[model samples]
Target: MKFASTGLTALLLASVAVPASAETLRWARAGDALTLDPHAQNEGPTHTLNHQIYEPLVLRDEEGTLVPALATDWHVSEDNPNVWVFELREGVTFHDGAEFTADDVVFSLNRAMTEDSDMKELLSSVKEVRAADTYRVEIETEGPNPIMPANLTNMFIMDQEWAEANDAVEVQDYEGGEDTYAASNANGTGAYRLVSREADVRTVLEQNEEYWGADQFPMDVTRIEYTPIQNPATRVAALLSGEVDFIQDVPVQDLGRVSQAQGLEVETAPQNRTIFFGLNVGADDLQTDNIEGENPLANRQVREAMNLAINRDAIRQVVMRDQSIPAGVIAPPFVNGWTEELDQISTDVDRAKALMEEAGYGDGFSIQLDCPNDRYVNDEAICQAAVGMLAQIGITVNLDTKPKAQHFPLITGFTGDETDFYLVGWGVPTFDSAYIFDYLVHSRDEEYGSWNATGYSNPELDAKIEGLASETDLEARNQAIAEIWEVVQDETMYLPLHHQVLNWGMTDNIDVPVDPEDQPKFKRFALN
Candidate 1:
């Protein structure tokens, strides 16, 4: 059992000089990629760093538009409706001069389906990945999968031979703290090649001259020096001092100051993510609460009361500095199944107190809330604000803030079900409700719910979530989504906070639009 942690895991590094050449883009973010192993973790920052050095069959442009990458074209086979046939791009080679072929696609996709791969859940519907020809591959799904392309945007492919040679065939066991060669090294068909890495300290990348899209893209940024500055003030100072060219997240409070500074710009966009708190309502007894042999969160009345106690507008105004949209549902507007009615939420303190009394917890109960300090914008502050709000409904919250690297495993099940209450930010790369249901709302099992920290489980709900992947009719699929969401909302397993708004701060010379998913492809960067 994980207790409340007062300390944070720090990544200490010495001050280093940042090259400010027009061809070099100095980048800084609040957190670092967990690993260089592409399939190890399905995280935004990790994928952002990996995208610079790796290529996926399908990629999302800065505007979140699906574009061809390794696969020149893809479509469901006319004869086999359940199979997705992909025409591989020719004349492509890995960084080590290995030819890219269908064999690599078959090997990599199967590798990603391994137990250790966090990308496995995304491919749960996939039956088999086989090579039809030298440059052609086919992915046979359990049924007709309409959203196959949407899921491939971030499913990076790797060189099978390289993995075998480096003994990195297995995805790195990140949660178990197992390290492998791939954890720190990479070779891909992407526009840039990894030069050096120092975990959370700093990393360097140089443009790949032989990259297939070298001529197709701007390729203006020849080198990328990435640094993760956990402290917001230090990160902002880095940008102000000309030490960094761009920052993925600009603190909301410093947006005006940074945008007004000489030769700087701040671009804003609604992120395709939701910030929320998870409750372990399935457990019989409270893990880290004041009351023993009783889980206050298990009671529906208590959960409803907790939800009512939360003031989303206050968090949006105070914690987010009016940068976030108060959310009623976990799904953002960009998702397919989102509706304003389902996203409408209200707060009533008196109603919450009455609900608590109805649940037989008229006085109060104390529980620990696990949160990440550097992962989300004002993450700790949001938890801090909620701690005070929850107190009004007689729920005493002990907030424990730590670096994401340490905090994520608490809910990820890579370690254990170590947390009863936690904060998590969910980004829908597929922009579908099924993606959310499969990962967050479904019951924890081999095929789904890898991120659902709450112990809540229902066999009927699990069947509905599974049906989404194979549902062919658009009208029927959407209705099923609505029904699933209704169940999720009524349970109140998660307390929705607000939809995050992204702010990318950069120098005026950079010409890159804000990606709602927060993954910036440097190859798309055009430096003036």
Candidate 2:
């Protein structure tokens, strides 16, 4: 009888403690992850997961300012603007019990500069990443770069010894999956640890009890399950049905339904991302056969014509369901030092037609347009809408929509000396206009390296981008950006659509902070 009474008491304690202390937040979304290797891909669902798995040297605050993360404090060299010194927080240890040190930072950064790595170009400006001491490191840049912290925000630090032990040294080839050592396995000095991964189905993460940080409210959230439910309707249904706690990429159409749900609430925040279309400016030949020229997009007039034909307002209303704000330039509002002068693009169809006629295409021609089906919110639908709009100007668009997995390689692969006209969205990690100039405006041969997929090249723009990168004076950098924006608009190398809103539906039990930059962090969330 005494043993039975003791067992009953133990069961009562388990009932109260299990639900209170060991809560598992089941989050759902409508996209599959490309890879878990943080350096392999720069965008999409992986970004959200990576946020939970890894902590970079720096993180952007709510106001888009760079704040320390892994590093406790840092200082820019007074003598040389290119040199940045950082003081590492001592006593921080990786999940595998490996100590965090300067060597890990150097290994992760140097590996990021490998040729085969997709994110190699992000760290291309760094001349050297050397350890000044065990608790400090200094990054010497190839030139005077102001946006160093912003650029390196996504360069998550890895365990050098752990990586070497697992034979994960060549970070370029690490694709986290069934056949890889890094797949469903991780060893980071972050707040969580990867417990299990079921591809396209679910990923489970457990709180790192050994995390050397301030106490987390859900100190032991044993199993946070992340599931990718592709259909928007199904995802929303699951949320309303109490199957999931949170659902991302909430369809704009169902915002009303979600908002009206009994225990659910809807949240909308401006994401520092720009959705745009790239014309094949650098390609030797146009993908379409109707244009009989050497390179149709190469003609400044032709590029402008394509831009004006698409009614961005209609796309914002219909395709995006009014969830997007029309964009004038590549850089969005939240990006630091972004000016109003940069938002200068004419939406005149008649002028565009005149330009097209001058370029010898009075009647528009047929072309194949490439789009990613799973990359953005309603990405494929947006492309379909664009096809109809382009058709109005006699431009017959053969839309070739593919999943991001298949789409990224074919178009972004510059090896074939080709890239078809395609649609893409860039969420600027650095939250700076310099990111725009460096990635899109600067030439592939330059110090920062290549993100110029369209092959849009101009000597004037290159000089302006270079000037902005190195310019210490705030006004001087802004002036350089203004000049670069003017040249880009004049050339019409890209068609800017709108900065789409990120809609999320969640229970009011948690406080999820919103930053226009969309860092995907819930640094202060807790269950009521």
Candidate 3:
């Protein structure tokens, strides 16, 4: 679907309404957005919050279909196959009343490619971004990129004028623990505007009256009251007591209670996210383990043993409350490179013990398992369960749990490794396997491997992973993808857990679909 092309004056006049009829939506979740700066953190919750206030060149609808946003139309330039052209939407204005133009598009794309931007990995193929005209921009890549548009769905545009005036042109150094004005303030050309922000506490937003698509969408929600409720009981109670109108993270343990409550309903869908365990296999000596001067994870047999020790079925039934699909591969089914052969693994404690004994560790060792309590559904609980399962194989685990804000840094920061074993979740925004290899399996470097805490790197695999970006032939590209997955599976780089199932609890009065990405845009919402 495309945006309405009728003149903006008609759109504004048709959307104007009395304030007395305005509807307010109270939303609660387990964790808050990491920052208001669009390029600061490439996290799910942060992108969800920014989707309301920031306008990207392209966006995904509730069904994960790509749609035009800031750009009305886009296509590869006929004269230059390596260049992509984007035509901007007319009569659009930023939240601060700044005019939207190609300059802002060029600036925002360039800003997102900077060293401090966590979004740099998505634009690694772009060679340059230049404005062709007042409302047209061209992005030149090093090679022909057939799926370039897929990469821009989350590349939000920022107002160059507002950024420079506020000294916020530089993206916030989130991993380095630096804060800037843009971290707390926002200015964009989306359907909503930020009214106030109190980090980790509350953020309020009001509908954009002069929004370009005011009449193009339902725009039923006039105000949004977003709160981060970490406690599962409090989040459910807020919904039951009418303190909040909606919640995205409905705890699996309380799904029955919420659905049985009066005036409430639970909507569910399969999420495109995978939860898994990462081991620091690259280290010569485990930093967080009792086995000194030797890394047990460094042995392939040991890693395979750990994978066998995990009872994915048990975790799915007990820890996830049957709300997750036990997975054998790191990539979800929605991604291009996933296959049944790659998604098949079995649990065998006896085999795991034998592998440990074969690897010269007859007496099992102990290690620390770092996990986030609020990031994934039953994240901490999953680690705790793994601790017990590993104990059956004589391997003791020390579980350390904390909020996501504190746990994410141990993996993403540029500093030295801080985790020996960790529980983490990954979602493929680009819906491709290259996204997985580049960040997780590739060697840690400046451009890629920002999330690879495993310390595992293979030069041959790295070359194959990088080749996917420029490989245009679909047949050959898929072949290479399959080959890479074969190696990744054999190496047992990560212990795959399961694909999460989404459960959204809301009042019956609101009509909205559960997004597989777990991001629900209020502009598409309606009061039934």
Candidate 4:
């Protein structure tokens, strides 16, 4: 009976395996966009492809725990928290068969730090990348970087020799929707090779049989295809119509529709993504350069009032259809080590009203609220809900909604210019609270961090963050992070919102892992 069961298992697996001649797997997404360079964009689609074609020195497991990838093992120097030594796996080859070495790692680090790279901000303190030998590398950071391994997970390594050969040694200064070779062409040491990219239509990748880690999985999948179908309804339609195998970012409104589909399965997981409104505190008033009848938002009382006025619970229920959990901090609870002391601000409208009145705004004034219509799950509707709630508190909000493409450039562009107030979602790639304090709350130094978009800055908090970055002691570091959060919350840099939830729809034949990191990767997925 055991022998018969084994035979049946083998037969089932063989039946699902694609023939060697079937070289392409058709994949689909919301739309065609963004630069092809892995470092060009921090969005989900970019990460999805980056994980496929580029290999990070370190990677995270399904549980969001750190794991070794290109680097076989690593150690921190006893003398300095700033120094990290990594031993590379020998005998690994880039997609072009060029030998992987320490030089390539160093070159990749330098390129990622180049001013042209959008990814440069992510590794501002990486002082230098030096090779100890052909198969070993040492990174000397400006300060203690406990999140080095996690941060490195996003730095996809490129071949130094091949890049130099093609004059692509430098990361191109390409913006989303811009055409560049790095966007169109891919050369890396990952498990797949780019076969063709037909803009919005589809991107095709073939199995890299020569991949050094080929034995890691029973890789019967020979091809992967990516298509962008931005509309949630359309995406679900395609999956149900059998035109695509998998679909992500399923709208909560359509959960019932997709769940009822025959031969399909819906898998849902809580994401670490936080969707919140970013009030441009630095802006003196609305973008129109005039203060409207007692600008309540121009005062701290008004800002806090705005925070208290909205009920996140209701937004989760009505807009998200109970698909999301209310958030208290920027870092989600699942980020593990960081969210132990997570606390939510009070949702007392009475206090909010009193504060607004004390700020000399007995009568509320009008202000424009910008929102990205297509960015996060039910993003626009959430903003609409906030507007309605704020209106009840006597603040009149003029809603201006646009796609992320137009919204981001106008609000949080390189100039530190932002809309009066806008809704934005943040995912801490390092899964650390320091990312919130350093980038968001510090200052938009451009060279340093991301969270400072609101132009929120506190010298004392900055110093604490600086000290924590290099502190080797885990207790001390965690304490420092807690302090930073206290300062951010007390000062109201960003109104804390709930962590997001991801719901993906797929056919029974496809199996995909759900990661709170929110990067939709298909390398490990298989046909059941």
Candidate 5:
């Protein structure tokens, strides 16, 4: 399971070959997958890497259409409204030659609900999972969940036998810094097989010769070499120099340069992610701030002042190079509950200063801002810009920037001492506002709030958010969604920034669509 030190170098050298048929794809991104454990992290790049080796029951196509993957068909049980029945696809085999069956589905779903699993919140409604037969399985939820299928699009299924044999039944404690067998090794019924993996360095995957969908899909790619290039200039240089064939993130500053280069093309798409700032409003006292005896973020006037002080337009134009869409709400435009009225906030530094003074902090205060340098596009630069803008209103900011691997734990409910202020980006995979309310806005608890490092909690809003899961009436569910947003907007629980835009740079011979979720399935790719 461990990668040989010299094997990665040999693989990297072999990856430069350009077959006449485009059989190999050298892919690079800003950050590497945290772990190969399917249930370990809910991160975008991690999911993108795992998708090549593990698959969920259902998946989203290039156009965001839901399609069956491991499961052939699924529906609610006629007799029991709270139970859903899924028909597993037959003739599918794991890379280890084990047959895919209902037991794997049952086990994988239960594993995803374990306490250590980052995917637990997505399956909070599930009461139990039962395998009816070799290829049939049933899931009983706590209540009737109309959109249960939507939740399974990213819940990857792991082979029960493979996990038990390898003693990897427990999900890796990524946040706790505990590495397990699953962290470095993988076994799944995906399109590609893991040939070698050297964390943060290189990972090699070859086509699964016995893949069940070999005949169904074009299977254009025979080999995949993935690299994690953290530096923007280095990433673009690799692509421009033909050291890499494709890169998921094409820096805005180099988009024109890359596009103009011969044999290179840039594909752009509106991402479904929103980047924003989180404040510890629920804390009684701040840990990283100089304010004494009280938390400044707890003051509504102060929070509103911070929100008004931010100029999203400037960040969009200067930092994002006019590639991002300025946003007024945390939820993106694609989500159901988004409205123009809710997304119409304007910047006013004068009003912001007035609010700060009205809150009895005319002299201002100092706090630290934690940000990730490699996670989002210009993530660190964006935080640096915020520091300057907040300084205008007398709020001195000490910015701490690090790689996402080290920076994410500050906000992912890992450390006891969470960051008082931080920058994070979120994407709505389920295409619902309830996803936002459940994780970001809800009160911190064992089941939910794993990502709500802000410490903001309200019992009334928590009940409404939990209700969205079982509310079968579409209108009623949407009403609850709107009510939750109203409170979120009024409280300024998160300082909304802007929606990110995706730019993928690849060789002219490669043809792949930009996925809104930022996950590109290599199996569906075609090379001209």
Candidate 6:
């Protein structure tokens, strides 16, 4: 229950706020990372913080390009199409001074694929990782994965020796509340080293003088002071008052105020993420619903009614302040399966009511909606809008708002589909549709569907989703992706709200562009 209350969380974070100096950057965001164990959580804020302290085999730069970090180059082996060969970067060292080698790569990848690892879905195609030599490693997959490199951008490499020494080889069971050395401390071969950490309050980091990328990238930021301010006004005030130099999430309502302020500037871009509501379609009976013997969400008519009830245009204009792109599909336009036609949305209260009546729920039914207050841009506002909209279709929504730390776990199934309906945002780091299918659309087999709380499972669809890993034929793979999208849309699996728009508020003296994924690499920041 850390950071359980917004007012208290904001006060605690504000008390620890530090001033920015020429060699230091004070960064503020809406939420703090759930844990420091890099592979434990696949979340935006967590990955943003971890990216500074952990070195991935490959990383998406400020320009969103797949660039090398630990691995110098990687390609499929000529001997075996299912095998990928990676050449490790030489002369690299972790924060604790452990030498980077192929053994670390092999060990880290194996660890990330464990059951407790939230990042296992990205490596689901892999069969094994083997160290071929001092600086060479081989990853054998179940089939020929054409986009394996794309998936490794966030697969952080941990120092195997350091992990073993600290007894942190296993991924921290984040949802289970298991605290280990790795969760509170970190040792990685990245640009910054963890100086101090206080969950949901303050985290201090210092630049690694011995970082291998020192000469390669800008490496301008020498020290960092990151604070999570849950309140939107407080976050904006920190940037305005010069207590913080940069804020990753600039509230849409405050974008103009921040931009017009004396020394502040706002940079915006279309984020590669979509916000949506997930229904527990697989459940026979919903725990929160007032109705008995059956789950309204399980019925396609009810699901369709809920989907049709959402007025994306209204939410965009009012709740989002026109800072969103209305989406009819969960996959953003940046993803492979997205189509202009599929991104189109329509709303009809009469139609939705008719569908609800056809499903035999003519009067109404009440269900609880678990939403994150600090996760996305105006997340609670969007959920609040949904409440009134869904009521038109005879579904009374009792809204429950929590911090991202508590809210995300509910959708991730730590308690096994703990809530009937919830709000979640997804960004495709791979820019591939398979990433969505593997995690959000796949059956909740505990391995494939880490975020698929819907419980809707189709063996045939699952086979197609799994086949996407090794399918080398480009056209065939794309066709299969289209087919999968068609099924998802037809099933009315989710109520997709809209694609997010990112607005970063920072001091005018800071030089950094808005990252499409909203994950800014501080090493790229330059002081004007």
Q: Model 1 RMSD to the real structure?
A: 3.1
- Candidate 4 has an lDDT of 0.72
Pick out the ten consecutive residues of candidate 5 with the lowest summed lDDT.
1-10
**Lowest summed-lDDT stretch of 10 residues in model 4?**
1-10
- Pick by lDDT: 2 or 3, better one: 3
lDDT of the candidates, in the order given: 0.89, 0.73, 0.87, 0.72, 0.89, 0.89
Reference-based TM-score, model 3? 0.95
Q: What local lDDT score does residue 502 receive in model 2, on the 0 to 100 scale?
A: 84
Candidate 1, residues 84-127, lDDT tens digits: the string is 99999999999889999999989888988898888888899999
Per-residue lDDT of model 3, residues 214-254, tens digit only = 88899999999897877777677777777778899999999
Clash totals, every prediction: 0, 0, 0, 16, 0, 0
Candidate 5 stretches with Cα past 4 Å from truth are 1-21, 414-416
Candidate 5: tens digits of C-alpha lDDT, residues 417-482: 579999999998888987888778888787888899888889988988988989999999888888
Model 1, total clashes:
0
Q: Show pairs that collide, candidate 1.
A: none
Alpha carbon deviation, residue 64, candidate 1 (Å): 2.5
Q: Could you tell me the lDDT of residue 137 within candidate 2? A: 87
Best by TM-score: 6
lDDT of 1: 0.89
> Which regions of candidate 4 fall more than 4 Å away from where they truly are?
1-25, 31-33, 78-81, 174-179, 288-296, 336-341, 411-416
For candidate 1, give the lDDT of residue 150: 92
